[model samples]
Target: MHIITRCEEMKIWSLRKNKTPMLHYFLFAYWFILLVWQNLGAGGSANRGGMDVVIKCGLLVMLMIYYFMHATGIRRDILLMCMLLVGVYAIVKIEGGLDLSKILYYFFPFLFVLLIFGVGWKFELNKRQLVHLCNMLIVVVSYIAVYALIFCTDQFANAFSIDNAYGNELKSFLMSSHEYGMYLVFGIMAIILCMEFDPEGTKNRRFWYFLALILFSVNLILTFSRTSILSLAVLLIFYVLIFAKKRLRNWFLILAGIAVLMVLVIPSLRNFFWEIVMKENNDAGRDALIDFGMAFYRDGSVSQKLFGWDYAPIKAYLASSRGLGSFHNAYVQQIVANGLLGVFIMIMYSVVTLYDIFRTIKTKKEGSHLSKFFISFAASAVVFMTFNTAALFASAIDSYFMTLFTVVVPKYVNQSIRAGTFDVPIKNRETRPNVRRVYR
Candidate 1:
């Protein structure tokens, strides 16, 4: 729980009012490398133990080191805060009489996020650059989509067992469908934002973006991951009710009606969708995991509850269950991995984020209609990560785009929305601050 979050305000959320941006051109190459590495199918071993982890962590360290040469406000504060976290973690291990070498495996992987936050915390971008970033995210999805097409041609070809009803789940290159599903959530949102914000002067761009959006949605559904599906559903509802245009809402409703009609009229489709939902709806494993986690916490020593055990402590349970690994529940997973203090920090982070989002909705400027929209995306993204994902630190791709959208890009959009600059004519723009204006 030693987040030292008071330090969050020590640096702004990386939003600056500068007209010219400090470009990190290396990011594009970095992201492309991540994309290829992930889809290379090296499996979790590659991700967790191989040079992949070293390369990622090393690249981030280099970036932060370079950043310190010119860093001032947010970058410095955020990096120092991250160092504070590492200090707290090390102190807990040393004071708790645990071997730091044994826990280093658990500790080092998390440094990637800390390093990324240090570099990205105060990173700046113009509106056009943000749109380009989102476009690149869409390209990530497009690559995955094509990969899915090539591999999951049957959509149900990769059956687990004869007894397993949820057959042929689309995992793409990922071993778990949920990871791919989570990856698509951010990609889907990126497409939506890009569709709304990307330059419109280019011909047929909307058609292509919309087509990609449809494709991404289909792939997500085919993942058949309950948590991911629910996460996307919540995000879509937030978009429609809070930010979408009336016509768009109506269109969404119409599409819903058509989808329902097709499901009802087609017996096979209805059964398939129903089976996807009910496959493990009554699975007792999750409840049992929760029971075990709570029981362990209640019976453990005070130190144990403060910092979790290095091991899963559920190896017996794992031996009996088929394909079941760690706890599927994120909160329980956090409790087992980092202990009660970790869960407390996680919950407190969400509380802080939601409170800030509430303030954003309450204090929108007169003409900043999309402020609520931007805040809604940020809020839903935070909620989805806190409740659904097993880890708060995202994959390399999601880390890049999510940080850009939630923390880096919103200030520009919210400000331009307030100035009415996006919708205003070019002649009226002289009165506004000298910064990038997203023209409608």
Candidate 2:
């Protein structure tokens, strides 16, 4: 009886301290599970009526409820309008528009809103909180990844079966199709983690970060994903060169040492790396897809060319003509699906967020941990996007990260604006100090 009373007391204390319902945690978990499972090709349409649909629907509903709870504003309203337009466009083209699996895309605005305002618009995670959350996530995922590697290798090698205990496919280079997505997510996470630990200032942190780099690098290699391998390397190099707080020469030396060690220690990796870079057929069918997309852009009917082919048409085109699900190139996917206009908007949105993140990095009062981490995150994200379609508009992970940063960064800018500490953007059409104006 005493233990039960103490448990109840603790629960109430946690609730009051966060001032958020327990439901927020549940929704977050559900969303994360969905995110992880997206790589596995789980439910994405209503026709299947699977558990994925149920989970996605639950997430959408919960987020919408959260949005209303926080009181709607014009900014959110305008964003939602744009999202709805895009969602409608995405749906009319796809086969199962309002189905269970595809519902997640339809409600992306809800996800963005929930992240920003679900709990009284308190989405601004300060430097400490961001580092804490990202690092904790990395530690948890990295442990699972390591365990998966050993367990899958042993279990699959002996039994000659596909399934492993850790829920990855044993025989393939990647434990699962989701490996690409995981690489993208965790690759960014690793950069932020290293930035948090100080890329150059301290010896102890450098030691731990190098360990993390090795682990994440190995994880990327084992997955055998060329896109991930390239992106992860780009992220690490950028973190060292652009975001590190230490000496540039030393940073280059450390990166060089790691590269040399990797080549020497992992014989198979050297072969794989060379094959991806030096081999002829490195594009993995991207060339053909681009041809088809460009051809369609040139020859398709007026309406088809304007909106491009809808989802159904594109899927149909792929199946009847080429036999595939997507164009596999994000930029082409945008052009094929929604025409040049949609592609333009998508690019602009990405550019806007990237601009904001870098702008904030420039404003970092020297010696602030937050500035360094933000710069690292931004750099990793930018470099990763160049090589991976996972950052494309169709991917929920890209949308989630971009929207979260968009809303949060502006808050910091608002603080700067109020303090009259305009750091960058010296252009002055109006003689009033060239700081960002606070949204009314």
Candidate 3:
């Protein structure tokens, strides 16, 4: 077998008779559009009726073609496991008397999961392409952020004021402040990873990335979502401890100290922290929701306990006075919708993904770009799953990126390992400083 560098692979692909590389770029652009305009309807509702069907169907077709044409191999076990889980859920939905339309809606997640896995497993991009994609994401998100700051700031202030006099959270174009925060988190990670992976550029490149970082960080803070804040903090700490150079680490510490000082010294900052931590009472609401879900499960029959009550009943229950319209936690939601089996499947995938990431980190050289991005993305995924439900299983924007990274990073790691490129430690490498080498 002949091993090829990413640049060489890209060149070869470009010269191929097939237009698969162009198709991949198109798919990436489509995916990016999906992420940016995920919630473009009134009151942050996703317009899932009109063009959404067309987009999804188009994606399904493109993905099938791409997979069959380019995928060198497939993970049969993973594919089969996913199919089995989806099959069980479909059967359960039918048994519970859900409408075909609603059942089809339920199937969207399964399709999305499959599509993401397929693309991640099959499609490959070099460092330059990946960085270009990230740049596109940053530009789109930054535009959205700037638009929100200019047009929506007053609305956000007014909305927050209704809840508390001092509240000033910004939700942007997303459904919630938390959702916007999550978007910013991904943008931040992308900017940071692109900077680290392809750093041998002009001074202007560094300045732009630094500016983007500041923009993303400011928007994240303005969202005022505790989960997002905590997640960002964790990502920064992970990067600083695991990937940052000594000078960067020292600067990070100094910035951390200053943030702490501001939190302590500023009255409004102290009040904001208090509001988020103490006065919000989110834990109580979350606890009640969890208890309700558990009690509902305990009262279910054996079949329901095993295969779940499906979508209709769950929807009705949530619409009822006793339910909160949301499970408030993804794990709990899975249990309610698909029972213990569903939860098991999700947990299995998460465990496998984390295992792969850890394995890559251990085997790959320190400062490996793929490994670092994997760690950053994995950290974000963990935090996103901890607080939100839609990211992994749904066909939303966040889910798109999550699925893309989840599949691509592992494939890249495997390829690097197979080529023996990951075996050499960073300190031992004698590569040129100007060239960025990565797997395609």
Candidate 4:
């Protein structure tokens, strides 16, 4: 009886109500499973009436409901507006409109960030804790990645049998190496924020974070993803060269030395590095796809240019003519999907976010390290989404993850600043003025 009572108490303690529900961790778990399943081409689709669709949507609805319970009028209004805006935009005037899978995969997580972070609801944890929590997620995922590379192999990350690049490609849990690249994007972004927010974190914590960053960087290299690498490079340049603290900058230099040594010592690694730099992945096939897209766009009528034939017809036409569905270029995908309107909306995704981020950064110059991370991210994202990397309208999970950072994350961070609810205590807080208004 005593043992049973103890067990029951433990369970209750774990489930004790917090604004950040532990169940959402399970939601992340499901997302990981989805990545792995999709990697293996075994994942279900909405058309097949897959349980993945039901469970994903159901979990999101539940998360929203839980937040609504504690929400003030403002929170509810924001949540409702998020739902309606995403719903109406994603559905209205599109081919095969109202794809639960698309909305779930592409845009659903955008709103969830608001609930956990601040705009829609506040987790019991402070902003510093929340940011670290996110970084720790990368560390956990990196551990799994190590295990998968060793024990699972081709099941997690695939062996590259491509024409030019010859090595193991890291695409664990997602369909493409490029998508996995964005996973690293999220990891690196979190690390940047954590380091800036808490540069003197415990030695043990710093070690673990450094380890996670190494793993993420190594896999990013192995992925041989050009745009992803370029995006990260820009961020590193901005941070390490321009804004990094002395201690952090030294560590970066040390890593650079190590990378140089590896290139000199390891022939295969050297060749692989050389190949990525030389743009070995470029080919005529990609060019053809771009050509087809431009030609199709050029031939469109005025009405089609304004409203588009939606993405379905483009996919169908591409399949019928070229035997490939995607244009392999994000900008081209926008041109064909919803024509000029699609192109404009897609551009606005980055443009508006960049404007917001810089506007925030401009106001935060006085002893504020918080803006450094956002500046790094905004610059990197613009570069990443510009290539075959995944534009906002590309229907790739990369795009969705990017949106979470570039759009939703910024909004909430701004909200937290204005409300004075974000509790990230900096070592230099005493030197800076109180948080000022983030521009509209």
Name the best candidate (by lDDT): 3
RMSD of each: 7.6, 11.4, 7.1, 10.3
lDDT of 3 by residue, 1-440 (tens): 45444432212122122112343365565566565445663224444654655565565566566655654434454467567867777776665475535644566666655644533343434454556667776787788788787887675455424444224567776667767787788788778877776677424588878887887887776676777788888888888887788999999999899989998899877766666433453563677778888898889888788876665567677769664456767777778767787677667666777776667666655334466556656676777777766545555555555655554444554444433444343344343221235645
lDDT of 2 by residue, 1-440 (tens): 12212222111112122122232243335435655565345533333346655665665566556544533222444455556765655655565445544445434543444344333332223333333445555554565556656756664243323222223322233224334444434545545554654445335566655666666555555454544455555655666666655786486778789977897689765554554332333665768888887887878777666666645556777878765666656667667756776677666655655565556555555333344444544554454444444433332544444333333444443333333333322232122321233333
RMSD of 3: 7.1
Off by over 4 Å in 2: 1-31, 35-50, 76-122, 154-181, 184-188, 191-212, 257-272, 276-281, 316-323, 366-388, 391-440
Candidate 4 residue runs with Cα over 4 Å from true position: 1-52, 66-126, 152-163, 166-168, 199-201, 246-270, 276-284, 317-323, 365-367, 393-396, 424-440
lDDT of 2 at 137: 51
Model 4, 1-440: lDDT tens per residue? 12212221111112222233343343244345445444444553323355556655665576567655644323444456556655555654544564666555436534654454333433333365446556655765686568656864653343233335434456664556777777786787777677666566635478777877877877777676777788888888777876787898899999889988998799876665666443555663777778877888788887666645556666777789877657877777766655686577567555765665566566654333454566677777777756663665332445645655665556546544533445644332333221234333
Off by over 4 Å in 3: 1-27, 35-38, 41-54, 97-105, 109-123, 155-168, 276-281, 320-324, 365-369, 406-440
**Pairing residues by index, what is the TM-score of model 4?**
0.70
Tens-digit lDDT track of model 1 for 1-440: 23222323355343323232333344555556655665574455436445566556565555555554433334555556557766766676555365433344345434544443444433334445556667777787788888898867777353322244455568887656766776688788877776665557334587877788788888887777776677777787888888889999999989988988998899766766666644647553667767776786677677667876554335446547635666656667667667887677556544544554455456565434445556656655555454343444433454454444554355444444444454543333353223232333
Steric collisions counted per model: 2, 7, 0, 1
Instruction: Name the regions of candidate 1 deviating beyond 4 angstroms.
Output: 1-32, 41-48, 74-84, 94-122, 156-167, 199-203, 277-284, 311-323, 356-368, 374-389, 394-440
Pairs of residues at least 3 apart in sequence or in different chains that clash in candidate 3? none
Cα deviation at 195, candidate 3, in Å, is 1.2
Q: What overall lDDT, based on C-alpha atoms, would model 1 receive against the true structure? A: 0.58
